[model samples]
Target: MATSNGFGPRALRYLESARNLVGCAGGAVGLGLHFAGLGGVWWPGVVAGLYGVGALLTPAPKPRPPLPPRPEPRPEPQPLPPEVSAPPAPKPEPVPAPEPAPAPDPELVALAAYLDTVPLPPSAGVDGLLAALRAAGPGPVAERIVRHRLPVAVAGYLRARTWQPWAGPDDPDPAVQLGREVDRLAGELA
Candidate 1:
């Protein structure tokens, strides 16, 4: 009729039954594995290991002792001396600001200008655009064009590119695929 700590006797009994069931299940599994030539003679050891771990984990009960009353310690007293204060020091001067960064390369500047001049339109069919990109030659610009058409073309490309999953958009951890999708979506939407 009595309870200890947080759990009642019924709960404790249920826990014991569950633990016994788990132990039996583990032993049966180990035995089966051993007979199947998977676990070998180590099956008994495995069972014993599980039981040992369970026994070590099981909580033991102890009687609660009475709490002792608290007594505060007395505070120490301080002696006063003659008052003598020193003057504060002067503040330091401000630091010099950093210089501006150098200009970008002329080739990079020209490329940026050229890219700016290029008209980006959603109505441009992906196939025609991709063909144009391929014809333009192999470079970052061509890669950028393919990246732009990814949302419309990537899924089909990926499916055909492999027998197994080619790290498609539907995949759980498709970081590169997701980036490509975003870039294409942004390009089309823009």
Candidate 2:
């Protein structure tokens, strides 16, 4: 029988029970007729046996219904009219030019000149080198040293002045190295 909410497992069970009952009634009627002499015993037995076998072999339950078709996705919405569209692109601001580096210190210039007069090994002593550095003052010269733009020999001479415990007499003399750096710097400057 049809149902308002569609046939369910309970309906299937009831139908299966009814099918079994019909098979049993048919078998009983065939036996009763045979006993009453309406048909031969073998004939009725055969009919009842066929009915019972058919009932046993027949499938009762149905397969589940196929899953519902999936809904198709909607397309993306189109852009709005120009009047309601995004604001006009912003103008790019101008970037300022970088400042030029300051000219080299005048004292450093004069120190290079003085170094030119001094011979190799700096007979004037370490005090003379210190004096030249003092004349150049600390600011610009220190910046050059920090940046490592100074010649390697000059850098080595400056480092030697710090007199770490590791430094020894066997190390190349700072004066000789300084002389080489002076020659290089003077040639470049000239």
TM-score of 1: 0.21
lDDT tens readout by residue for model 1, 1-190: 6556556766776556646556566667667777888766677797676665654554654558978878888787554444644455778887888875544434434443543454433343434444344445455655554444443444543444453365567554333444455456445443
Q: For each candidate, what TM-score against the reference?
A: 0.21, 0.22
Q: Tell me the spans in candidate 1 whose CA falls farther than 4 Å from its real position.
A: 1-5, 8-25, 28-83, 100-190
Q: Going through the candidates in order, what is the number of backbone clashes in each?
A: 0, 0
Q: How does candidate 1 score on lDDT?
A: 0.53
Residue-wise C-alpha lDDT for candidate 2, range 2-24, written one tens digit per residue: 66665587677765674666677
lDDT of 2 at 145: 36
Full-model lDDT for every candidate: 0.53, 0.59
TM-score quality measure for candidate 2: 0.22
Q: Give the CA lDDT, 0 to 100, for residue 9 in model 1.
A: 66
- The residue pairs that clash in candidate 2, if any, are none
Per-residue lDDT, model 2, residue 59, is 68
